[model samples]
Target chain A: MSRRSFLRGCAAFGGVTALAASLAPLRELGDYTNTEQFLQKYYKELTPSDMTKVITRIEGEVERQYGIRPHVRDLKPMDGVEFVYALNLTRCIGCRKCVHACVKENNQSRSPEIQYIRVLKMPHGSMDVEKGNHNYDSKQVPEKGFFYMPIQCQQCKNPPCVKVCPVNATWQEKDGITVIDYDWCIGCRYCEAACPYWARRFNFTKPQIPKDKINPDMSYLGNRPRKQGVMEKCHFCIQRTRVGKYPACLEACPVGARKFGNILDPNSEVSYILREKRVFIQLKEEMGTSPRFFYYFDK
Target chain B: MAKLDPSAQKKSDHTANYWLGGLTAVFFSLTIFFAFNSKPHVAAQPEIPLVDKKFLDTSPWRQTYADLVKAKEDLSDYDCYACHDKAKPPRIRYDTNQKIIIPKEHANIEMSHGTHERNNICYNCHNEQNLNTLQVRDGNVVKFDNIPQLCGSCHGPTLRDWEAGAHGRTSGYWDRQLGDINRLSCANCHNPHAPDIPTREAAPGPHYLHEASSHEPSKSHR
Candidate 1:
């Protein structure tokens, strides 16, 4: 063989070997799950009867795995209502109560560790979010020179995650909540990249929630046990909020720093806060996301 | 030494082999036990102190104002007539320093409410003529159930915030038509004796100080 041709042959051999080596992790597809899950239709395509069947299947799976029967529902949004959250920055003592409470209520993975809320500790003299620190480890919170701000899914009026989903797995509901269909998500994580708040959490492996500790109250679009290779986020506690109850984080707050209400109602606490308090949305002007969550100070 | 018989020499060698084998087995077992029974070593935590529990417990107002109102008849706290003579108006006494001395009967109250001993007199909040009812600064009579109004007379802005649902917590339905809303009274979260919220032990952060100090979100993501 000519010397040039011999060199070309070696290059092709090395290229083939490299490509094969790169694809080696596809062997993990052995755990890719059953045909039933693969064949299931998209969330929008599922009829009410089909949804009931899916719920029954989920209930059965939960019962089989956790040894407890769960009542899961596909709760729809209410008419003439749009949700808004108002947080009092002065009252929030950097207490992580809302974070733990949200994890328990949402049935997030315990071991692999998916938490929806991240409380940032900001210095007193500065209002810049860039200066806020999430990993502050002070013994007591509101540590003399800092104010606390918890970040979560802002549930933007114009959600970027919904805009970036490749397979149409997530969408914005009527009541101003952004929801993801775990079944439809391809786990490509484009939406995770698109989020400005770092709101989306992807299950890198099978979620490891203890069976005994699993919250029995489940919802179809909300906190039903998520599988491996899916994305989940804060759905505004859809299961409770739709049923006219306060979000778990709001109920768990000791100082009542968090507030929620229908913005459509002029009499709601959120409306009054927006009207009277010195309120600002996080990254609102720069991102133009128009978040439903509002942060306000009493002074 | 005498020359040994062939069988005797063979027997001695066998006994020596058994002894070596037994020692080997014992050492192997000892190694296995240590491997399985040893505890994993953990790094020592830094010397950061935890917040004391006393700072976090605000359970004095466990009997919220609303609850006391709803269960009014059965409650003895409002029955000021039970201990004192109904005919006589209650007397307020002051020490030589002009600080009001809490009466011996009601010495359990710990007064740390206002700065520089302001709002110290009992009759400032409690009516002199009617012991059970509260008296506002403007001399308006308010029932024990309506302490918020009495408190509002002095703390005008706070009461305004509370009325608008910006001050304390309000649980139950956000949608008022769907379900009833339970607006918590001012005294529920704050102590009448000590209105200041004490510093508290925060629930744990995502990581310990060592792991967290170096962690920061990229500015590009902001």
Candidate 2:
């Protein structure tokens, strides 16, 4: 054979080999081998009856897997309400109570370490996020001159993550929380890359949640068990918050540093923070994400 | 159509049959190989223990007014009239350092509120005439449930922030129309005597998958 023909043959062989190798991981997906899930309709397309069936299927699957019958439902956003968060930098002591509280409440994989909130231990003067350390070892909190800044999904008005999704799996809800449909997500990781705050967590392997530790209260778009290929971020505890309850993080905070409420309500705590307090930080405001989460100082 | 070439035709047909038979044998063998040999992969669950319950608890340890009201039995500790006289006013005592010595009977009360030692007096908050009632700086008597009014007289900014839901913890519904709201009073979280918050044990840091499995045991959170 001529040189050009030999090269073409090699290229074809290499392409076939690469394609075969890419599909090898699919063999390990035994638990998700159900044909029923593959045939299920999209989130919005599912009618009320369809939703009930889907919820039942989910409940059955979770009960079979974890031996706990979880209460799963799709919580729709309430009308005339826009959620916003105000974190007091002055009062925060870097206790990390919110982090673990979120984990317990959200049913995040405990072993593979999926956490929604990350409190940055920053030195007194610096405002740059890069300077903050996440792995600070200390006996107690509010140590000396150091201040804490807890970061989570900002639930931005204009989210870059949503813009980059190849599949329309993740979107901002009416109540200003961005949610992900685990069933529909194709796991491109484009949203993970697009997030400025490093909020999105991709499951590199199958998530390993302990049976007893799993929060049985789960919502379709919130703390529901995400598969290996999907992405998950903070949904402001949709399971609790949608039913007119405070997020676990807010309830857990010992210092009362974290504040959350409807921005539409003029009397809300978050509104009061924005109006009266010197609420200055939006965290990457220059990125134009228009995050609903705000940080403020006492002085 | 060519009947004279039957023997040649038969030989060619036999060769084609052999080829077809070999292909069919190979296909069946491959199917058997896959069906018998390829066990469906199941991911092994990692054996990572949950963190201690000390870290998982998120609720505030302090008692709210509603909680106090609900537990009527726990209210005996706050009953001042049970021990003190109701008719006579408690006499105010000041030492040379302008600090009132905490009486032996009130050993649980730690009266170090301000740097100036001026707010340590019992009458600063407590009603002198009626020990059951608490008084503000304005000499107005306030109930135990309305302790925020008395705290507001001294901590004006903090009280304002608390009223606006900016400074303290508020549980229950953010939407007032839907559910019951629980706004914690001043005494719920802070001790009126020593207003400064103590540094307690913090929760454990994140345990990454690849990192060392066990975390150093931290102190229990109160």
Q: Rate the local accuracy (lDDT) of all candidates.
A: 0.79, 0.82
User: For candidate 1, lDDT tens digit of each residue in A1-299?
Assistant: 96445445555555555455545546544345445667889998999998998899889878987799999999999998899999999899887778877888898876556779898888888878789978666666678988998989999989899999989999999999999988899999999999999888888766767776688888999999988889999999998899888888887777889999889989878899999888965554479888999999888
Model 1, position B194: C-alpha lDDT score:
68
TM-score for each candidate, following the candidate numbering? 0.77, 0.83
Q: What is the lDDT of residue B56 in candidate 1?
A: 31
lDDT tens digits by residue: candidate 2, A193-265: 9999989998877787879877899999988787787899999999988888889999888888999999998
Badly placed stretches (over 4 Å) of model 1 are A1-32, B1-61, B68-74, B81-100, B103-107, B115-117, B207-213, B217-222
- In model 1 chain A, where is the ten-residue run with the lowest total lDDT? A25-34
The CAPRI classification for model 1 reads as incorrect
Q: Cα lDDT for residue A178, model 1?
A: 94
Off by over 4 Å in 2: A1-28, B1-47, B64-66, B74-76, B79-99, B116-118, B212-222
Q: Which whole-number lDDT from 0 to 100 does residue A174 have in model 2?
A: 95
